[model samples]
Target: MGHGTENGVGRRAVLRGGLAASGALLVPATVAAPALALSGRPTATSGVQSGDVTATGGLVWVRSDRPARMVVETSATGSFRNARRWTGPLVGPDTDFTGVTRLHGLPPGEQIHYRVLLADPHDPRRTGEPVTGTFRTTPQSRRSGVRFVWSGDLAGQGWGINPDIGGYRIFDAMGALDPDFFLCSGDNIYADGPIAATQALPDGSAYRNVTTVEKSKVAETLAEFRGNFRYNLLDGNLRRFNAQVPSIIQWDDHEVRNNWYPGEVIAASDPRYTEKSVDVLATRARRAFSEYFPVSTLRPASDGRVNRVLRQGPLLDVFVLDMRTYRNANSPDDQAHDPQGILGREQLEWLKRELARSRAVWKVIAADMPIGLVVPDTTEGLPNIEAVAQGDPGAPLGRELQIAELLRFVKHRRITGTVWLTADVHHTSAQHYQPSRAAFTDFEPFWEFVSGPLNAGAFPASALDGTFGPERVFVKAPTASNVSPAEGYQFFGEVDIDGHSGDLTVRLREQDGSVLFTKVLRPGLVGQ
Candidate 1:
């Protein structure tokens, strides 16, 4: 998680007035449940729920306590008077006892209520306590806007459950924003370092926690990946949020192994990566990613791979990139001038084409790494490369490559209203990189913002320090000019686009939802 601008949920004005008025305008009544957590197991609630309804449809998720069939209901109320229903049996170890049913064929511009009914196998007369929640579909085109939560690096070292506290806070804050969806900017789990075996599925439970680093082995196996996911979802607050909002997710290093590059090993720099081995990891990661996330994967990668994009609506188009499965190791310090390719040639071509054809009011590239922070210069005056290497380098590499691409793409195509967003630096910062008369006078101005960890190991004091370092080198911007904070920590990225005036409002927030900073980027300012 890196800093783009110090900020919080400071866009309340925009949220209240103008095109941003889709602030839960349709969601009327709240459910009557006390939001209780089940005892003695991670399956706190009997079922699962997901929200942030869209124009077309939303999602409903649940997990059975035992082998069972469930009938999910979507209605305008608790009574099944006129509800939309989906019935299916929970199957396989693949879902880890959970089932996510995409509820389709709903009308737009209305608030919908939903719940799950565990059909009793024996009597068939008894139905388990119904779990209910509500969501508001996107308003008319002119009234719809886009908002999403972005953060990364949620692994912690010593504290048992302290790290997840920040993430819970983030969810509450995001609930206020009422975004159509939430995004996982990567590093969703810290299965790296020595604690590779600690991730697990607790006894008789649907969820688990990274109790000890000793057991959280880097997810090298399928079960390990599943357990890593279970550990994060086990948190009560996280579970509640996930049940309430359908999350659109993508993967970064920690999801597999930290700082992983294509066809290469990080430790020994060995080039012994096998297609079978790579596919094994990819398959496991995608399984866990798909099982736990609400995203719909329709256009699977052409090679029978897993890459896909979600077109939420005309307001936003999210292109979820698969940089890990294909990317080469970040360009080493020696090759900073000629960075090792981050986006493999094929993926790069696909991404450029996607951008070129997007017609949404806003195009959101859900990246899991910082795409603008100049790493080498940021670490220049620091302890040394050795010190910087102590943290993941994939983030800085991502930022570097994204910056290069954004500048070239916007200028070359005369594209307007493109925003770059990323997470993994563990702190918040925002930057508006525009072509300067003295710098690149012919290029268009673009903006990139970075958000820090939602929950993770405590960042070093040096990260917050204000000294010339390799990490600080990329702070050059429309505001900071040439100054970069030597260090900072714990933040997330948020952008509010006004459908009324075509203006984009961005913010970087701390754990408590305090706005550390803010910036406004106008579509008219591009190429200025």
Candidate 2:
């Protein structure tokens, strides 16, 4: 009863499961080298495209623009003399012409460079240029200093300019800082259709997906997910950034469907198509996610397949939560129940045990939604309460209840050196919730930082300020000018952990390397 590769196919067996069902329509195999285009033909995309690198190995990603087997090389230099290599056919449409070669057996702490070659007939040169990246092995537990990036919600649906601007800016800033790994909060794409459609941004101002009115559900399918990922990979800045740093990614509502909770459909928000089941949609999204992402599956029978967690050094341990898949979105009886739970019984118990055994300096829970924000109405000046779209009286209440449960659990456990990172609510901010009781007195304080929309939506300062401004009790002093209503920027967060004192320094950084805000917290900061 061992496990299999991504498609759940045994490494020793010859059969394929999952997306392998669509193998009939895949690209036909060709010779190893690149074929020549006519005199004026454009160059096909090229290089040693790699992803999800860890201390031991990385998933080397590449594809042939034309049908051909690919030869991938990994080295510590541009020339790659003593490089480790992998060869395989760029198979089926399942990978969208891409091949994910698992590069194994390399020395740790060494900077590695890599490239891909299509040795076929047309053009015998490397498909993509020699792309270089650096990776370090997971450090020993006693090691103290470590740096990493946390971000999510890059689902810019309409008006492409926002994501383009934000993506470029974040990469520009990240290139300079060069953290060890990148963490996503969630909602990476606004793929609004079912399990087989494509997501396209319109020409004008609308940023939300037009799914409320669209007929086809194909946009949210595996094809669309793959397409969205391909589009994301196609971004020069995103690709360049990926080429340089290994990423730890998690999905949010937009990555599947908006506000998608377990046992629900997109139409669940409206009463019109309540009977429609989204189980198939979820399956497809999961399939696409596994094909494109490097996440480890925690479930026993995740649609009959399993995934494992990715680890780095002693400085960081990420328990990436698949919050959208297994938990109930709203309370079973009442949507606005005072203590509506989110992590559900199973995950809540699992998390408690995981936290209890962690030895890393930073144990980051990469949640897709904020566990700290009082969603409904903590204070009135917030846009959600004041501008409730008229009849939405229970607006913020639902979110408030969810946060209460998470805080209660953390307080009860007296959890220390723990931080919750989330997305969903587009604006990024750090909130510290203080417990009101003695059972949780020792761990009465916790910090929740939401980093998102890497290149997705723009945060309206007026909106965020209204929400977080008035209810400022026990709030840490602002590190930069309070984001004003008229001027604000799309941004991401960088977290650097100081192992010496168990202090975590959080920085709210704009895409262009400017610091929007900064804050530092400690395990002892709470209950003081």
Candidate 3:
């Protein structure tokens, strides 16, 4: 049942030593190269990644340069000797040679070592080199602490994979923290920004990107959108990080275009997009996103909804929302009705029900867009196309009406330890909403933390809507265009929840892993 020889070692000992059972058999530098060289087979270009982990199972993802068969081997021990083999779907041109395999029937709260093997499409006997990855399942007991990281906006605003500086080095910084998993808040890729081989910096120096023909133009077709995902895998750091940290990914506007609504028509003046209809382009983008990431819940449903709940043992419950799919057109004059809001009636009801039923200590709303931020689109002129807000700082209007209702429900239900984590504004900030300071103060006090632009242009802060009485506790943003990671403004957020005390610590970190701000919250401490 196992492919490799077994080593006599316990899983706990292996994890405590920070080494896998397979580590003893392979050299770190030559693992991928020597194995493929000996077999004369095409190796995986994007390495291996594991994600969407539960107590019993998880998903593993890989991308090959050519058509191949996806095979995965998992073991309780690191040596992977006597590991259970799971044959996955075909990795073919239909999915841009990327595929994911689900691993099931594993023990909870234990380290699972896995290797990804790609077999020849025609000859199953011939296999490529194996890429190794490890992930720990969610703890079954309520006594174990949980930690995870989150961020958004990858490769945006003309920022691309730069070989000279090591592409997206911030991922490396995040990976070093060794969290349980990574939650990609949104904007996994920038389909609207074209990447060039060389980008001139504001300092008059040239910043180089490892560009491809598909990335040179704005993504339109399905192939182009898939290429955007493949392009980010070119970086060795990202590939290594993906292998180590399993991801829970969600999408935002840049995954298709900038602040695009569902049924909007592309303006002819924008030369980059030739697809007149934005929905058509979003369909292509959504398919590519599903194929590339290991999130199993991203499957296309009949109603076109992608909202789901991710429960990590008894510690945390993450409700991933689909903000883009059912949203109305961005307009200030829109009515304050539930059907015409950001989260439609159906989704809002589901969120409330899930929050009320959740037994986890912390209830996290993984919103792609911020609540109070004033995001306006003036391309069509006049009162401005507002995505989530009507820009009225005083009262709830347009999309804010739905959000206000949700907040009120939380207060009525007396839900404690509920926090919001979002990334879309391409900056990092900590906001505290107090009933006393807000215009409409029916809900209990809560916190919202924003961090983003994994590698993108940084912008100024957005004005907050006063409907929730949000106060800016902390803020950090770059004053320049297309800021690089070396500038040290790029940010990510980490949440660590202690099982014993039920205390939650939220830390906002810079690109270099330095903490920008830290907040600690205890259970039943709402409005404190």
Best by lDDT: 3
Ranking by lDDT: 3, 1, 2
Q: Pick the candidate with the highest TM-score.
A: 3
Off by over 4 Å in 3: 1-39, 299-305, 380-386
lDDT of 1 at 86: 88
TM-score of 3: 0.90
Ranking by TM-score: 3, 1, 2
Clashes of 3: 4
Candidate 2 per-residue lDDT over residues 206-307, each given as its tens digit: 222212112223354456566655545434566566655666777765665554556754444444333356666677766766666544342123443221
Q: Better model by TM-score, 1 or 3? A: 3
What is the alpha-carbon lDDT for the whole of candidate 2?
A: 0.50
Q: Which ten residues in a row have the lowest lDDT in candidate 3?
A: 1-10
- Per-residue lDDT, model 2, residue 67, is 57
**Estimated TM-score per prediction?**
0.71, 0.70, 0.90
